[model samples]
Each structure stands twice: as structure tokens, then as C-alpha cells.
Target: MDTKSLIIEKATILFQQKGYKSVGLTEILKACNVTKGALYHHFPNGKEQLLIACLQVLNEVIMTDIESIFRRHLSTKEALLSIIDKLIRDLETEGTITGYTFSSIVSEMATVSEPVRHACSALYENIQQIYSAKLVTDGLSNESASAIALLMTASIEGAMMLCLTQQSSDPLKTIAKLLPKLLKDI
Candidate 1:
């Protein structure tokens, strides 16, 4: 990764773990091992801009993964399970069960920063649309698909939080088991 991306990547982890208010520029610089001059060279607006840049990078990565998963799976349920499985594995391996950037950022900075809030909202809406489209393709009406997709997204995020809070992956696995039932009647 380049200097900017390297900074963002390190900052992303710190921000996710500590929240926007708690993570300082010095900490980000140290984590990234970049000088203040280098950070300002890439992010002239300072920490806020760096946070937004990190969100944008996250948005791109998530959208790309969504597209790839949708392309690889033939059914909505399969795609959903695949996503949940991937999350389970990630949580198991990285122990980043609590490292959801959107949840962390929005809860801390949404009221203070319009750009950061909007970037987070756009990512969530795009993710919802990805899930909704798959459900529509699986024969549900747009309205039903959209509604279920919203529920699924909320449930998944909540389940992830539970996994972190409880310090176990059981909550995620339980959510995964109940997921198929959400689409069964449709």
C-alpha cells in the first residue's frame, strides 16, 4: 500500500477499536509509523479527512465483496450464508468481532461530522441494496425483498455486536441458523 492507504489502514484499526474521539493523530501516526508531515501531505484537512478516507476505502472493499459474493452464489440464502460464514471465520481468526468501522464511527462522530456520517450512511444503503437485489432475484417483490434485506442487515450487525460482547461466536452461528427462515415464506 501507498503512504495514504497505509495510514488509513492503520488508522482504520485504531479508530474501530478506540472510536473517533479517543484516537489521536499522534497515535495514528505512530501506528502507521508516518511523520506528521507525511500525514498532512496526504490528508490536509487532518484527522476528519483521514477518517473519511478510511470510510471510503472500507466502502469500496465491502461493495466489491458484496458483488463478488452475489456473483458466486446462485441463491439469496446461499449468498447470505456465505457472508455469515465469512464473518464467522474472520471473527475466529482476527478476533475483530468488535471492529466494525461503521458501527464504531457512526456512534461516535455521526452528530459531529456530516461528511463522515454521509459516508457511513451511503455504505449501509449500498449494502442493503445489494442484499435486496438478491432477494428480488430470488422471486420476492421489491418491497418485501427490501424489507427483509433491512432486517437481515440489522440482525447481522447486532449479532456481530453480541459476538463481541459475549466473546464467543455462538451468537453469530445462531443468527446464521435463523437466517434461512427469514426467507422461507417468501
Candidate 2:
């Protein structure tokens, strides 16, 4: 990765774990093995700008993965199960849920910055749309698909938080089991 990309990547991981307020430019610099000058070169506005960059990176990665899962699975239920399973695996392996960045950042900086709040909202909206589109393709009406998609997104995020706090994947596993049942009427 280039220096800027490296900084974003390292910062994303650290911010996901440590929250925006907790991580300093020094920590990000050390993580990326870059000097302050290099970081400032890419993110002239400093930490907030760098954070916004990190949100963009998170959006691309998370959306691409979700889109890919939907493409690969013919069944919407299976696709959703796959997503939940992936979440469980991610939590177990990396301690990250889909919106892990949002969870960490919102607590600290979201209230203070419009850009950060906007980016986080956009990420969630985009994720919901991805799920809604997949459901529509699977033969649900736009209204129902969108509604269910919202439910899925909320439940998954909630479950992810539970998984994080409880240090167990049970909540996500439960979502994996129960969410698909919501699709049965289709």
C-alpha cells in the first residue's frame, strides 16, 4: 500500500478497536510507520479528514464484500445466512463486525462532526440498500424488501454489538438462524 492508503488501513483497524477519541495521530503514525509529515500530506485537515478517509475505505470494502455475497448466492436467505456467518467469523477472528468502524467512531466524534456522521449514515444506508436490492431480486416487492432490509441491518448491527460486549458470537449466530425465517413467506 502507498503511504496514504497504509495510514488509512492501519487507522481503520486501530479506530475500529480503540475509538476515534482514543487514537492519536502518533498512534496512527506508528502503526503506518510514517511520519507526521506524510500523514499531513494526504490528510491536510488532520485527524477528522483522515477519519473521513477511513470511512470511505470502510464503505468500499464492506459494500464490495456484501455485493459479492449477494452475487454469489442465488437464494436471498442463503445470502443473508452467509452474511451473518461471515459476521460471526469476523467477530471471532478479527473482532470486527460490518459496521465496527461506525460503532467505535460514533461514540466519540459522530456527534461533533457533520462529515463523520454523514459518512457513517451513508454506509448504513448503502448497506441496507444492498440487502434490499438482493431481496427484491429474490422476488419481494420493493416496499417489503426495503422494510425487511432495514430490519436485517438493524438486527445485525445490534447483534454485533451484543457479540462485542458479551465476547461471544451467540447473538450473531442467533441472527443467522432467525433472520432467514423472515424470508419464508416469500
Q: Which stretches of candidate 1 lie over 4 Å from their true place?
A: 98-101
In candidate 2, how many clashes are counted? 0
Candidate 2: clashing pairs of residues: none
Q: Which stretches of candidate 2 lie over 4 Å from their true place?
A: 95-101
- In the range 78-133, model 1's lDDT, one tens digit per residue, is 89899888889888998874344368788888899899999999888988999999
lDDT of 2: 0.87
| lDDT values, one for every candidate | 0.86, 0.87
lDDT, model 1, position 114: 93
Candidate 2 TM-score versus the reference: 0.94
